[model samples]
Target: MNSKSELIKFEEGISLESGDNLSSFELMIETYGDLNDSKTNAVLVCHAFSGNHHVAGKKSNGEIGWWDEIVGPNKAIDTNKYFVVCCNNLGGCSGSSGPSSINPTTGKIYGKDFPIVSVKDWVNSQNMLTERLGIPRWLFVVGGSLGGMQALEWSIAYPEKILKAGIFAAAAKSSTQNIAMNEVGRESIRKDPNFNNGDYIELGVKPKNGLKTARMLGHITYLSEENMDLRFGRKFQDSNSKVDGKVDFEVENYLQYKGEKFTENFDANSYILMTKAMDGYDASKNFKNLDEALSSVSSELLIVGFDSDWLYPPERGKEIQLAAMNNNIRSSYITLDGRQGHDSFLFASEKYEEIIQDFVGS
Candidate 1:
């Protein structure tokens, strides 16, 4: 693996035929380590929303991946042993095509005009990018949270193309409750005054406050009550609890901090669009049964869930495991005990890396 950033371009010749436009969808990708002669050592690290191609290392701009703790040279995804690659999702604000990207036809940002995205569409783009890189098949496709959804999509869509894969904190189908949460998050962005019908960028205004509030609302879903009690626990953010002050609670302060920092780089329109697409995903529509969907994949699966994760609970993973078992798929299960909730997958918690490392090794 080299420290220098390398731009691996998938030329239009080998890229996907875009349904929306004739222009090739560019995959702004970064690879760690070397692709073997057979190119079978490649492992795709799919990223969650708000993540970029700078998955494991720092880019030239100095900004790094959201999961910098993992996916490094000797880290869990271990770039030293396997060729690791992470591409920003299509319609993503990060390096990939999105609302922030310039539209060739309009001479303006794609904004709300960007076509609706889907899990299948994202997978198609990734499948093309991998092929263009000369990788025959991935050793595994592993991810957590929204990235976990992508991982599951790969297994369902091109099961034979991967050797082993893991899906963490995700469901075969986006549960209605999960979809509703996504809708509420979208509403926070859509109803913001600065949103301006998703044309705020043109009005010399960014939906910062609204986006911040949305993020704060989202931060609540990413945590558990136990974790909140341990971390916040009615603690005061400052000594002067009420000096004409508000947001006295540590949890409130914590959420506000998350919201403020997220809005600094994230675009409100991007948030709304991505969440909408996620809410609309349903693998059940394409399969006769959950087991049928599991049967299509030829890869080994490591289905993981956090016991304390309310957003996509452990039962969802058990349901996947049951389906896999019925299909006679080679699969294993791990339920981590963490009060970190859904976001536990991203942070350091227990032997998560070891579980993945061992699974891939098998």
Candidate 2:
């Protein structure tokens, strides 16, 4: 993939959905391929909650992107044919303006004082970036999970700016169960003594334990019970290391490893902010019904769901498709057979890839 990561500064600043205005801010973005003369071949790839702008390249640190499997030269996204752009969201911890960033006015980290950003805010910021890059419209806006939420929002908020969208394992709004799980994760972070009320940065400390616990809990929802059973299956991480009549299961070890790895790359405050954004997301909020809300979308839609995704579920993807179709929007829905649950979209399944290749290539 011919790609490079760069930072874009918004000199005119951006106003948040919460009525706050940032005097200046920066967004880290990664781009692949060259924009056509008309600049219409641009594809915007939105990342999941914990993901970053490094969507399809080997970074200077030698780390590959989270979605490298789906976005290289001959991959589903096909960088050789389309100019792909992915940005670190404004409230992201990964080289973007967020709670960890120093406040221009206060000369200290924004921390908890950072205004709560919603999915709409993120969309607006992305639009600004697109305009900055001289792109008139996106050929496709694609994402999975929280990224999918942003794709849906892009269609609703800026219909004229995109030709089509691909939303995978996402919903029109946060379900009750989803909100409950997010709340639990938030509680885990808040209860940690090192959290320091989200001001840990000033104290020269990080709420590592809290963030680890939150990631560990959230990870469970990303995979299906079937997957967990088939992969871990009551196996012990170390059969010889039993303590207090209990042995550590392989699953426990896996979760711990994931949690530790996540904490090493993510910020606790950003996690809270992202979950809040997810909880507050509702595409139909101001409309009478979902169909009415989606009536304004001009883009063709492709919604993909995993049969075993209990978190977002196949029914949710169907709801999005139905709403779009009822409103006379061109739309399609597909439920791929997979036991990986919500994270199935990230895997390199040939079926899933073929579906995307066909949709975008067509």
Candidate 3:
């Protein structure tokens, strides 16, 4: 086992009970600015699945973060004022533990055998990180998409420890439609002959084709038809449409780019497991009911949704807002015009950023 120091220098591995025999792990973190004696200015930013702890600029490989536009010294997550800590989720394939990590007994990668997890399990991990990093209380927790799910979980799980929460382009629970989409991607991986029951790594032949197909499919869902029309349209990339001289459509080219780029670093097994966990998120069942669950969330909230996010439409976010209101928890909801659909939050929408900045400033 590698010591905490070699694991990229944050608070490192901190374990917690996640109701299973397996001890769910967390990657503790720290950021710029001193935590006052009161420790109120700390902000915890939860990442979407497939996102790493890197939330700002380029990595050592010169790859910038997905949220680079909103997280920086003076950006929405402003390291200049409040300290920020962003963690990889419990089932993530990042610096923290996951299926890719080696199993102690078998001494091989866990692969498809990683334990299932939940939003509560994820929050429990972050709580360990918060404690290890000496952040007794958080000024706010901010995130979007799956990250936003974690943000909502933070408020419910540690109501007394957080002052406010920002949930953008997300649902209180993962939608069935979203689950079906993710399941289709997972099944694509499983159906690949190269998968070999998740032990294909030993064969030196990854299920690249099936995974690419899945990525291509997922890329389609992340975009709205309107956004696709504005960006890709029916224009041909190869400018050929006779007896199929070459592939046509700019949208096809865009999807190919997305798929090819995804397989470079992503693992199919990790994708499957994380999507499973996300699909299991059931906000209503956790408490007496949905309203009761929202009542348990005592922190102030900022909920933002895109006009075109059909995956978890703005109406879904309105239900969350109404839940918060019914419970009388401090909450605000905003909708931004975005044709890019659910992915607008990731693509750096100007209106999105402005609202996030306004909330962060609060």
User: lDDT for each of the candidates?
Assistant: 0.78, 0.92, 0.75
By summed lDDT, the worst window of 10 consecutive residues in model 1 runs over 13-22
Q: Write the per-residue lDDT of candidate 3 for residues 271-315, one digit (tens) a residue.
A: 887777678776776587779888778898999898888887898
Poorly placed runs, candidate 3 (over 4 Å): 1-19, 23-37, 239-246
Q: How well does candidate 2 score on lDDT at residue 5?
A: 80
Candidate 3 weakest lDDT stretch, 10 residues: 1-10
Which residues of candidate 1, in runs, are more than 4 Å off?
A: 1-22, 59-64, 239-244
Q: lDDT by residue for model 2 over 5-99, one digit each (tens)?
A: 89998888888888888888899999999999988789999998899998887877998888998998989989999999999998899898999
Q: Model 1 compared with the native: what TM-score?
A: 0.92
The local lDDT score (0 to 100) that residue 164 gets in candidate 1 is 85
* Clashing residue pairs found in predicted model 2: none
For 55-84, candidate 1 gives per-residue lDDT tens digits of 767766888677777777778777778888
Per lDDT, the best of the predicted structures is: 2
Q: If the candidates were sorted by their lDDT against the true structure, best first, what order would they fall in?
A: 2, 1, 3
Clashes of each: 0, 0, 0
- State TM-scores per candidate: 0.92, 0.97, 0.90
